[model samples]
Target: MKTSRYILITLLMIGCISSCSDDFIEVANKETLTDSSFWQTEDHALQALTATYGALHGADGSKWTFFEEIYVAMAYRADDQINNTAETYGRNLASFSNTTEDSGPNNIWKTSYAGISRANQILEKVPNIEALSQETKDVIVAEAKFLRAYYYFWLVTGFENVPLVTTFEVELQNLFPEQSESSVIWSQIEKDLTEAEANLLTEHAAEWKGRATKGAAKALLGKVYLFQEKWPQAEVKFSEVVAMDYALLDNYADNFNGNSENGPESIFEVQFSGDRSNGNDERQVFNFEISPYAFGGWELFFPSKWLVDEMKTDVDANGDPSERVYESIFFDDPKSDMYSMEATAKIPYSDVAENLNNPNYFKKYSFNTDEEFYNGTNITLIRFADVLLMYAEALNENGKTPEAIIEVNKVRERGNAVPLTTMTQTELRNQIRHHERPVELAMEFGIRWFDLYRWQRGSTATESIKSTLEAHNKPFSENFQDKHIIFPIPLQEININDKLQQNPGW
Candidate 1:
């Protein structure tokens, strides 16, 4: 999240409190803080807390590591997307051929741990700040805890069996801690989120818009439960989120625009801004990384033909093509309702027949080439649409198909798609697994991969995963395995910590 330029300056001024340092004890100047001299003022605590918030950014350097891990490792592997012929990263992920030494996983592992280290520093120092009120201390500590849990969530889910380090004071040997059981890691996640829910405000004021909120904590906690098959607990947490003032925007695309960030629909988001007058670079390069070469960008990732065909069948409440389908995709076809902004105006993409290979680009992050340079689109982590779908899944599992359809239709109606009034329990379950989530939340992040993982956890594993893959020609017969569900622990981490073991079938 981009704070005011002053806060960003505060983050840079407070140097040497960083993950790159091994000494962690030697920075001695006023700008370089130490344990004995720092944490005495409210400003000190605030600036340190701001640094903890900085850990949430997924992009570091120019690589966009956060997107690389979630999008490449998970989303690209799923059936909904495919890499363009020129992009190796997406193709490798889709084919299950990415290695442990792959930079995507390695970067996520390093950056996430770096965030945890910063957060631990805050938790260690914030409690001792007598200058700040108890309320202020609680909120700061809660935010740090949430950040720790957030980082760990990416770790355990993406890498599983991660080092459960929770403190700053560690012996040299203790630095190479062994991997903890997935269960143990999950317990720590729940612990931090529970405390976060208790302390974070229901809503942050406009100036503090992107800070974690009660809804964010509850929603994340519920997702954790859903991952673990604790359905009743998931239902309760999602119900609380649904009860909040959050609502879907009138237009589904509003959620992706920079001018309309922190809307009622966004429960949690990574705030990005293109304004570089500030010393910090908070711009998200998602579009730059994935846009067609024609847009002066890398043609890295695009929707599969299977996905494009799925959109053609989808219809709105008005019995016309779905607004979401049109809003979500752009390809070289006049019959299909998409246009290429990079192409000449008033010219059908079909006119460019020689270049057509069903070239589909994600229109969700589309922006004007003339107006602004860098993309400022906020990446939404949780939205009301997800809460509705998760709640509907819980209802369907509990044999409340009637109630489930009502919730599912809320998302459909927002996309201007017709709502289903009737469906058997089996159909409701299929609706969630196949239709609703893929159409509404495609290419967002790990949501699709997580859906596939959890679908296999059910009794209908055969019917759920393999069938979908086969029907869509998604290379289930190519290289995916039962053990391929989770990624291998990065080889570099294994080298550093001999106590760590790789996941099965790397």
Candidate 2:
């Protein structure tokens, strides 16, 4: 029902906003702007652009949740790693382990397409502007193009084939181009990112602190290269970003704090604000991670035991798990036995009473006791640390172990963990896949799955995650395949677009 209403409202808003009059006085003469008449003013163009940002915020949480569900948890489940409330999600997805079409994947397709539609509207209309500065207009167009590429990348990465739409004609409806090859979609993504990298200025860092930046485009381009095994290019692009002024935050915890949402380390983040005029901002809905039984918020997701134990391990027998625990995972009581309680009953009632006070749970992204944007911390979509890690990945894949360790060590030093002086390709690859990503990118959506795919180690890593969970007395889900990797084409799209092919084995 909520999804239905969202679509209705979006269509209505698009209609009202697209049409505008040419003359200033003529604007008053028209009954309100409708989809057919609105793109007449610079202000109108700006408002439309802002709406795209708003959609981005919504897509962050919604898309992130699905990415985590299908890519990360399902792989862990297939590996028998941890049980999930989203077990239904894993089970349903399992049926398509080798395939990709189903009802479950529909929402992501719809959401992404909606974003593309908005971007197409801007790309088509922005050029005609005699009103806005050319520079301003160029950046806006770049932003839209950047987003279009981002959305298509998501589809291509998962489904391998996706429709490529780059136009502004509602009459072109039913123009379901058959699933374009992944290579074709990637070529388009590369074009957008390259243009975006060259066009975006670093100066917009203030007004658009969390929005896309040149560094963001460069970093994304590098990631796309890494995905395609274009190692040298990926290495060069990531190196370029690393050379830029961005650096990792001194404290890993600060990156997640509400006040520091756009910290120096964040290359790009989804800008979620608390200043919603009509309804609650879903972006500010931080309660999803908090324990629902104790607090009013729902503890809908929790860190997998595989994730927790791996971080908790003494990688070098350094006597302690380094200082990263405080930032990566939350412990309700710093004094409690984090590895030992037999059950919830084993937990002292005193601890239960002080549950809200307990700090043992993951608290890196916690809200302060009082703040207007309590749940509104901007979620970092890409950060310098991620860039560093991806750089390390490209270097390692290219068989440059020493250079890769340098990248890994840079991130480890921040955690106070000992860094490897050297490692083999296998060791570096394993560490990058199992340790570095989970710790560095924990709680951020889809990092795990993407890492697995890049390494082609999804099957083994899934098992490894499962084993750790089982040993720790945690539940693990099972049976993952290709369809589980991308997601089913959204049921709605399949219903509407005949040219669309369901992912194989769906």
Candidate 3:
């Protein structure tokens, strides 16, 4: 959709004009827009919203946000993936040796706030635009609210007790406000999503595929409740989303390849384009970073041996490994076809020389070609399968074990895995936590890591983080502490505002 083109143009138009020639001091610059002159039209409102979406990928207009560092920060702490590169920040995060001064947390903090600031600007200015209709303004405001909640979700989950800035700030004093309690932040998220669900459209046109929808808001609200252990509320939200028009794609592989983007399975996706030749650098770098060296990729991160073993434990109706194993990772399996090979070549995993020694490389998002490059594959943030699984989890927690089994079976059937028989609530919970989620959603986003952070397996939070990582044979399990669950506030941020206090143990 050339979304990046809009972002680039809007950034230039809205950016401040800091300098002018002395000879042209009296003349007005028609090229640059001031805040007073910009918020006068519907088009300007849309442009500003586009800039907010742009901040999702590049808040500072420098690097792809989820490409490398952020991905490592979100996913590496869990056991599924391991860092293979020598980057100090990535290594520190993976090993639990990070400090408040580390760049990984700082980058995430800055990028999320950048998005929040843009969203706040829209919430403050768009409603007053004289040229916009009330309906249009409602939709735009709903989207801004959703984006703000999405950004804050990352902040509160990743960095607990962060400052809550709902309004756009111009004054220096307002910019450096004190951090709010996590409970307060959660209330704001729920409020935003509830309003968003009421106002957002059920679906968007094909041209506007990645914008937030009513179903997306409901699903995210369900997730928020799930994280908070509010089982009844989470179940209600998820049940509403289940009633919406969405389903699992028949071919599980369709979820990852660029072929069926924004299809029935997607609730929301981060839109990316492969056509950088047009000066629109919106391509995603997941494939480039995770593919094996044989495919001309950097091999920055790959599936851990433990995850490969876990995927092999499940078998389909035909008494073979589940189809998800072959589809999700490239391991040394004779039955699995190597996606990087030519279609007619019939290359299997065992035949690839690179597969002989490596544990496994991520195959879900890798381009099915030998050449290494960025791709336009839209990263699905919330999909139907995930919602179904989460619903199952919530249902189980709320004493609906049999009903929850129905939901979990729906996802398992799609993956060609055997369905579960009746089991106790505790047994089913373990199955969902240890096997179903890790196998189904590994290496996608920080799902695994976030799951670990929220779960309390032992007597305390510290025990949960340590035991889970230790069970997975993570190298840094021994280094985990209570403070390791949520990252310390960035030292640079604290230095800028004395009101900010670092998280304990930093």
Candidate 4:
């Protein structure tokens, strides 16, 4: 029985979040720590785990900051949206001219480590409680381990060689731990996720819906394998997940429909509730239901010309454009009330594509309904379509092109689009490159840039990221030197921890 203390943990954790900018929330609340004498029971353990989940969604409801760091900072470094605005870290990251001192990566580093600290605290404290059954304790610990690995996954992916810490204790010398090698960090992620898979429940009861499960663990472990290019392992893990209860929702747009959240398609979602008084709202001022509401709604993201044109290439068997194009982007539709910040007016997009003039807005995170507006829309992290594509990529990499297209068609069929004909491995690889990932998941978090990185990196890597950027007309491709491959370890970390050395090329 989870305690009413869930609210208490949220209040404490919110104050503890490290803010990127000077201005941040510091709630007026009673001291929670001193009064927390009832933490020995099952309910207390549940509240602690809930706190970890809260940490996942920007510590203490500092919504805009986390998205700015991981989504905007890292996402811009790859070819996705055109560099539209100069505010936040958008232009610098979009141009690939950012530094270790940049606030985006630095704040994310602090937040990521803070999350790890909380998970470590839970792991350390939960086992000692005599009130929890062995079964309950194992499950609780597994959740903590999974959350820890998730934070590290972001850390490792964003900044390759991060200092790894498991225990909550920090000695004088431990504040600035040295950067662990990427291989070493990968091993730790694998170990944590593997244990998490073993101990977590196969399925959660209705009350425990979004909590980590055996399916979530397997899906993530499969992704880790995909990132490392461990094809056969990735394929096997993805296959196991596909056999489970997860499936694609009937409509592509349903994934973003707030009422349709936590459906079978969702492997993991960063849950949000618009409790404005509690400061738990998602902070989605950028994508509002009605444009011209709230200072023009900012309309932060402008879809790239490449994204729009590519989407136009594929239509349904009925010759109508893919529903995803309509669902994912909002252009000059007179029916829509989207505000174009560039135009400085409350107007729909220009009706003509040729004259559209960077007037596109991302609709995925836009309003679903009045009550389920901005702050309440849960962000989908991994979905069944994404996993299917991962499985397809792994299969293609391992000389299984024909079989790979089967999964590709599975996704295409749901969208009512034309399926691929028989093609050689080389041709199928090109198809996945041009049609698959970018179309299925555009402007949905950082998938675009992540795909760009995976395709253009390392010895086994094929295709030129430079060419893709060129094809998209990104102005910064000329200056994106070889060293821009991964983010530099934040300079602040090096200044503090002498053991931390700067990544060579940065």
Candidate 5:
């Protein structure tokens, strides 16, 4: 089992503070922690780092970082997802009509910074612990660097330019730091990941399975280079990761069905648990958000018709519908089953009157057998198939289209989809951008949205965004502007810090 030591320590610390007497004057009370008392032991360092990881879910328990608003902000803007609910912030984001004051962006900003703050605290204090072995301290520091880079990646990608706060001490001295250039932020992320790759273990023990690994750092660094169009550099990094002991699971659905979490395919995943005892309530709510209403889900959003149409275009080697299509969506397929029900008990999604006219509900993360809304399924951030596809993309851009097809075939082989034949770099690029990636990685993370931003035509990033949205006949196509490429800095943040500036058209 993944360790719950971190969560238990947090609860114990909270209990310590709560139990302190109101009658007594507070002056370095031993029961209640101060900086002098804490940060003195290796256990303290572990506790602090654990809290940093916990921030991936939420700083406070109320707003789950990835499962709630952040997921909406990331996925809803893309052409693949349709927001069917009446939530104003969600609707505004989906339509590109969101402003600086939208709660989606604001909560994401807060959660990411909260994680960075905890990471910075560890970097500041973990080195000073007298009892920690140098080897252990180095690993802890490396992990902190990885986490800092992870949070900053989100900030830079979502908001373009953001404050690059590294040191807790420096942040305390100047709380209202000016935003760094996006290039500068990317450089820092590269530096952190480079160092992390050098120091992180190639694999962690079962107890530490969810922590960042060398493979995770290299994969993320590869992604950073890919975004910058550093094709050769990206290829090298992904090549190194592909050489690691990671492979696509035999069954694609096992990646999300909670049966194979922290399994061989996972490079990094945000840890969660269904057991709410010991202050561990980090389970995700994707099942509730994405499953069909007939299956007891809220039906907040459904797959766009464009995505369903795209997935259906590909066939397996047997000339049947692609297994990926059956695995990815609860469609009108007679072969597909819901809630992992038995074949005899299966119900076609089209049979339900409520879902008859709807496009399709996501089947990727909805692999539960019960009515429980929250689940312990870890949200995979990076996996081996993604690495293979990314490696293929980099190789294609680097003028190795034939070799790139090999990697793409590896992913397609696992999905039981037909492999591509030899093609030109431009042809292969279009394939990877349009067909390979969307079908393989839809409704997971922000892959589609991020791909739209990075896949440029002439000069502006919006060329790809505008063309893709228009091609899909998205309602937001008319509303999308060049400035919508990056979100506005939250108005709440700008209000608190006068030095902060919003993105141009906000």
Candidate 6:
């Protein structure tokens, strides 16, 4: 176990910032030490890894400074309520006309590289630590490789072909290169995850519960295959996860219950332990829920009205309310409490699609326990439910429609959807995309975007992007840009590195 002492050390080493301008590309090379002489011991190696993970947490958690939300938003237009930051990124994707001139894309590019540099620095040094056990060293290197692969995956997902940096040495030389092909980038990702699975322990050692495991590496590999539409390979990987011993929470809502941060269902989640007394602003998820009640801005990701209506019309055999449907959606109806009840009464959405906004905006993240409205809840990345759905998609794509439905209906049965004996490929696909996804993975940043990419439904992407802007009543051009499919390199990167070329049509 890397002692919590390292976490304290990282907090103490608050490097000074000379520039605070948003336009500045937070370069990694500037602050990074030029020589690896200081990184020699096993403790030193572990400290560096802690520093990388610590950076994953931002100043007060006010904004996910390290995690790039823009890339995920760009993947699907429909899944998010776009704001000033996301609009710039999505505009590029919707119209597909972004250049290096775009701001949001530039931020993503810079942050991702910063993380890559941190991971690479650890990889380059950890191998030389002779005191550490070979198993320990291998696991640390695998962890760094996993992080690097994650950064590369995000880069490819957003920009398609991007520069792939594997070592920290290159940064010391200020050597930047042109973008590589997506296939080449993915090959590196595959290599890293393959190595990670081989070296990483399958289960988290108690001290390492929140850290990545062999399962995470396998699941990520599965997702990578899914993105490439390699149905057979994807099916095999997802099946492996299904066969794992993980179990879903008895209640669908319990999986995301903030109190159960690392519940049995969570494969991996960004860990957030609330430290508000220390001035931590770790409450965005809470803020999202408290909007209507606290008289703060109602920024809840209201389920699309179309989705809620679909659920109301859907029925299961026992006829109890859909196990997946939450109470926030049902207040207005006569049989339900749409008009009268106060404390738990359903709140009305005021967007253009208010009636269409599914009242069932996920209550999973909605607070039921009496904690500060929005403190740190672990945001799940992969879970048992997701594995089930992916298994369904992979099977469907591979022409095993019956097996696919069986896999899908297992989840549906849990969520209280009537078990279907069969569904046409198109119907199964549509159901998963429209209802299952939004409800199952709502606001789990980027599920909507990824789903859109997989389906090749550009028109829905356009409408979804438009709806978010229009819902905010923001102005937009009538035409969508195809170049928006990928984000632009941050303008500062283009300015600093002469060889770094911009994406098309910025």
TM-score of each: 0.89, 0.80, 0.93, 0.87, 0.92, 0.78
The TM-score leader among the candidates is 3
For model 5, the local distance difference test gives 0.80
**Every model: Cα RMSD to truth:** 4.8, 6.5, 3.0, 7.0, 3.8, 7.9
Worst 10 residues of 3 by lDDT: 456-465
Relative to the true structure, candidate 3 reaches a TM of 0.93
Cα lDDT tens digits for candidate 6, 87-138 = 2324543333445665556556655676677788778778878778888999
Candidate 5: Cα lDDT at 390: 95
Instruction: Point out the higher-scoring one by lDDT: 2 or 4.
Output: 4
Give the winner by lDDT: 2 or 5.
5
Which model scores highest in lDDT?
A: 3
Tens-place lDDT per residue, model 3, 1-506, is 33463373333234455547766546456767778778889878988888787666656654455666666688888888878846443788888888888777787898889888888889989989989999999999999999899989999999979999998877667878899999999999999999998999998777777888999999999999988988899999999999999999888888898877888998888777765675657677776677666655667877887888899887898778888777888877778764542332435776676544366787887765233355678888889999999999999999999999999999989989999999999889989988899898888788888888778522212237788788888877798887888889998899999999889888
Candidate 6 — worst ten consecutive residues by lDDT sum?
334-343
In order of TM-score, best first, we have 3, 5, 1, 4, 2, 6
Ranking by lDDT: 3, 5, 1, 4, 2, 6
Q: In candidate 1, where is summed lDDT lowest over 10 consecutive residues?
A: 5-14
Q: On residues 251-305, what C-alpha lDDT tens digit does candidate 5 reach at each position? A: 9888887888988899998776766676556566777777666666767887888
Please, what are the lDDT tens digits per residue for candidate 2 over residues 1-506?
01111221232334323346555332333655665456767767766666565554344335344433433332432221232354354444433342334433454565566677777888988878777888888888888878888777767765668888887555655466667887899999999899877777764745556556788899889989888878899999999999899887787767875656666787877665544457543344443443324544344455665566677762434556655655566544333222112232223223555554332344445544333324456667788888999999889878798999999999888877887776788888878877887777766655665565545523322334333333545442244433345556665677778888877666
Residue range 229-253, candidate 4, lDDT tens digits: 8889999999999899988888887
lDDT of each: 0.74, 0.62, 0.81, 0.73, 0.80, 0.61
- Identify the runs in model 4 with alpha carbons over 4 angstroms from their true place: 1-39, 278-283, 289-295, 332-357, 371-375
Prediction 1 TM-score vs. true: 0.89
lDDT of 6: 0.61
TM-score of predicted structure 5 = 0.92
Q: In lDDT terms, how accurate is model 1?
A: 0.74
Q: Which residue pairs in candidate 1 have backbone atoms (N, alpha carbon, C) closer than 3 angstroms, thus clashing?
A: none
